[model samples]
Target: MTTNENKSENLIGFNRLNEHVVFDSKKEMNYAVADHLKSNAAFLRDNSKNILNYLAKIASHHNGACGVLYDTIAERLSITKRTVERCMSELKQNNIIEVVKQYSKRGGRMSSVIRILPFVTEKKAPVGEDVGYPVGNESGPEHPKKPSGSKSQSPSEKDTNLSNPLLSSYKQGTVVASLLYIFDDFRNKGLSRPKFEEIVKEAIPEAINLKAYVRSVCSNYVENKSKFTNRFKKHCV
Candidate 1:
């Protein structure tokens, strides 16, 4: 009773599909799927290692199996559709996967082509690492560890010796350590107080009117160490 039109429109005929069709026989598809999965293996491990094995199984089947679909991914991982959407967004934000949308011939349905890319390397610390105190006052202590072969100087003696400003805090942490880090960062660039303000503005764009804050902090820093500030004026330049 099947007509020519029906035969032509029969996209997937479950009755006619051979048992061998269950396993993918297409070599190129298999290799492409495997390579794509491998490229994003690091992301799988870092974000959700539990989904790695399931993702691999789904990716391995490639006999016209359009890459990785959202529903299939959700089912395989036992995750909700919303959860898959969230994970996909995170992966995209982190540059783990690239989704390409294209039109399919069958009923003009839109299909997504998944391309797994290498894991992104974040340069800055994730959040709450607390590089240093954004605001502070008062003179802090000198570093506990002394330079090799040199006798450790007293707090006042250390201040006098560090007239260059670059020789301030010898270790990390504390307000002094933060200041020393900032000083050394711009030493080669020949930064002044105004230039330092520009860099601070870059870190905090909303602080465009933070000039008053900068002036107050700098004034306090100078007032607390007037003697040292005078000695280190040239170094501050």
Candidate 2:
């Protein structure tokens, strides 16, 4: 073969080799993430594990970043929207995911863009071997330790009520009253007052009018009690 023919063959071979390397690297990265999750399962919340799994699936489909809808996730997972919100918060707190953008509208709400963070582990390379990546004792992002008596708020809760006076006006008691009135079936369902308050606190952030939002949620529950029970099994169970 001529010199030009040899050069052309070399270029084609390099391109094919580069493609294989890229594919293998991605496959290995995925395996590493799964291994890290499995190894650290005990330290993560139950809901957080579910959220991570869901995000992983989403990331696989969307090329590393995706928009996550709290309500849709709740509906699909048979959990309350509050649970989904809390799960996402936990993941962010632990440095497992980051919110790329916040969801908002003039009078409507939408999903937030989320990016999953890579899991790091303390695996030392053997002597005289090159691992290509740094291995350290620390894993993931280090968050400052919260002081005692400090309460952590989720991303959704940060500026929600501050911008909306109607949402801020409805206190815990008012919300509970609205829920009780609309959800008559829940009156004798053995649900505790504190749990009700917790749900109200979570739901208030997304409410344009707190009272109306609670009433609507309760009305929906009343209209489809069985579906509500199934959808909110995390709370009911």
Candidate 3:
């Protein structure tokens, strides 16, 4: 082949490769968010997944962010606006998404800017691995060595998860729904959120896997509510 023809073919091949390749950060991150929620069956309930996926779909086209209107989301998802609000509350508490800004005009609320956060894990790095690089290491609930007391909020405050609420409930670095559910049960039972979360946190390290423990607690906590605490005390306390 002539040198000129060979050069043209090489350029064409490079161009063809470029046509199919994508390196957009927003697209990649939106995909990671979708995949994380999809694979982790126990990460969140289906309702949460629906709204998250919808937001993600919008965000993919809008540079990793999109405006949020609860009514619009409700209409599109075939759910009540209250349900959308409540699930968004849960997502906020779990650090799944963040609201960058809220808009208001004429003394009335308008649509808010929502930022989609990609799911992450808190796995311990291998020994001698570089720990200097920053990861999303949340200082989660600690062991219940000496429970520090805090002013308790009213029941409504606990339910609402207010930013300025009196009590500090738990938030996880990783999305573990059962842990949060058990904490919710404890909240209903009036067990102090911080203390109980810590107590449960300590026991987690000793378990081979949280699956059996979480399943037992979750099932017993529901099926045998009265005896749930005693069974849990035997294992976790």
Candidate 4:
């Protein structure tokens, strides 16, 4: 038989072992079973299009289902553990496989029992539904009735902006915008307008840190008029 045929036969054998079923004849039936297995495997490999093929090969060696450690798989595949974890997550998301059980070790190490799904099967329910109900409790306890005459205060715009730095920085007449405006006033400023804008764009996501840094620098600049341009240049660069 060809190499592919041998691989198909091995996969079929492993799958049969998972189901705890025995077969008497391995000659005539093997060829047909191998062909069917080969076709399904090809389809999954093509459609899923991920590290699933490597994962499946490893699972096949352990009789179609096993508790696979991410570290071990990473070592064997010569990839990082994070990559293996991501690939496994993708496979789970696509319903190519399922985690049958989860095992945890001391020191908080964890692994999962992954079951290689058959290529052709009835449509299964979403990941955790088979266990019982959908994940979160739909019938959770309702909030207790509020005491009479107890009014809740709505947050002011200042309070809201303080909680979210992005909003705070974008508010009218904020120091962040003022810093940029003041810097643009210098005719021989080394930085281009585009470059300064780019820096601000990069800083927006990190608004809290930028806000703190700008507040401190701007405060110092206000006290020393000669230092404003030099300090802004240093900060921007």
Candidate 5:
């Protein structure tokens, strides 16, 4: 083959390889997000639709991002700039994504720095590694430790009312539905908040800390310390 022809063929081959790798990266990103939720079945249920949609969009657009602007996302999604900004804010608040200020050579406005998080799976103990202590032949790893104070409520108890209504304005039916779904997943895996929090950190790479959203149903419980404690006791066993 001619030298020029050989060079052309090599360039074509490199382009094909690059395309293949980029495609795999996108799939892996989406899968990582899904696996993060799977790891924390409880928190996943409570996530709003807006958050999920925003994530899905980011996954889809990661490949095309030389530098995308809010206007571009808003136009493509058929939503207003305010709505797009709101979703971005929520995603940032939740530690899902971070916005870095960047300038493009052809830019009018500054662009964001979009970084995808790494995938996190449970760490399995080595096949038969033994520590200084005896290894109990227990089935799986011991169940994850729960948070210190949160407990479950019985069926007959009534909910409390709150002085600060905003915090309590979380929708109960939605919260419960999300919680039930997540808790069932947690039960099957025998995991708890600390473990679940670790998984959430993996999903949201920029998130250094994790916090649950205040549920609307719990609004009444926020007024007085006594009322909050009583209501907390009533709902949770």
Candidate 6:
């Protein structure tokens, strides 16, 4: 039963929760989830989307992550418990949220601690875990600092740009392209998807306004770039 159905058990239920408020608003959740989907080339149905957004909405009161039972979510969204399980499984499989099992004082299993990681926005990522969050990175790139008395990373290992996802030969190309589409006239001047990644590595080695720079380069590349950009963005939808 929900806390509202009980008078003295509000605190009891609240105790099982984890205070990991990641998304302040549902819109933030949407942007984060959208990026995840695009980056991974994943999809979520309407029902699954409903659950994900609801989790973010309810997280504010519970310090962000919802540590409620599947039945609790079923009741809130008016869905079946099994449906909640399936939707949650989908979210977990997507790496959008991590399900950390919580234990009670007596060591019994409590509601699972769901950490909907704050979407890494254009900010400096955490040192060890690379945990960057927030909408803009006014600061410089988040380079992993060297240990005391330790040698620096090899030239190949240094990541100079943390303002956005870095592109690479194998993995991060889609991620950079996925993020840049947000800006209008996001184009690639013969530089494949991942948006001037090769150029960033050699030319603009700092974490400057890559978004504006991208638009500038694309505009210089061709006129009526929005027509091409709109066409390219079709796949994103």
Comparing candidate 3 with candidate 4, which one achieves the higher lDDT?
Answer: 3
Predicted model with the maximum TM-score: 6
RMSD of 5: 21.8
Top lDDT model: 6
What are the per-residue Cα lDDT tens digits for candidate 6 across 28-86? 66577667656544467666777776666555455445555566678878999999888
lDDT of each: 0.40, 0.50, 0.50, 0.42, 0.38, 0.51
Q: What TM-score goes with each of the models?
A: 0.29, 0.37, 0.40, 0.30, 0.31, 0.41
Clashing residue pairs in candidate 1, if any? none
Supply the global lDDT for candidate 3: 0.50
lDDT of 5 at 159: 23
Per-residue C-alpha lDDT of model 4 across residues 1-237, encoded as one tens digit per residue = 235434434533443334321122333233323443464464443323335554455455453454445665676567788877676776665445555432222223233345554333223445653311111112223334446663332222112223233333333212222244333333133444444444555544335566455434444444465577679999999
Tens digits of lDDT, candidate 1, 1-237:
124322322332322222112124545444533554465566553324344334434333333222455665676667777777777776555443445443333325333444333222223543644222111112345556755664544443343333223222211111221232343334444445455544443323223344344444454444556667667996888
Q: What is candidate 5's lDDT per residue for 93-145, written digit by digit as tens?
A: 44344444433334333323443333323233456642211111112333344
Going through the candidates in the order shown, the clash numbers are: 0, 0, 0, 0, 10, 1
RMSD of each: 22.3, 22.2, 22.5, 22.6, 21.8, 18.4
Between candidates 1 and 3, which one is better according to lDDT? Answer: 3
Which regions of candidate 5 fall more than 4 Å away from where they truly are?
A: 1-24, 36-66, 104-109, 119-237
What's model 4's overall lDDT? 0.42
Candidate 4 residue-wise lDDT at 237:
100
Sequence-dependent TM-score of model 3: 0.40
- As for lDDT, the candidate ahead, 4 or 6, is 6
* Candidate 6 residue spans exceeding 4 A from truth: 1-19, 23-42, 120-237
Query: Better model by TM-score, 2 or 5?
Result: 2
* Best of the two (4, 5) by lDDT: 4
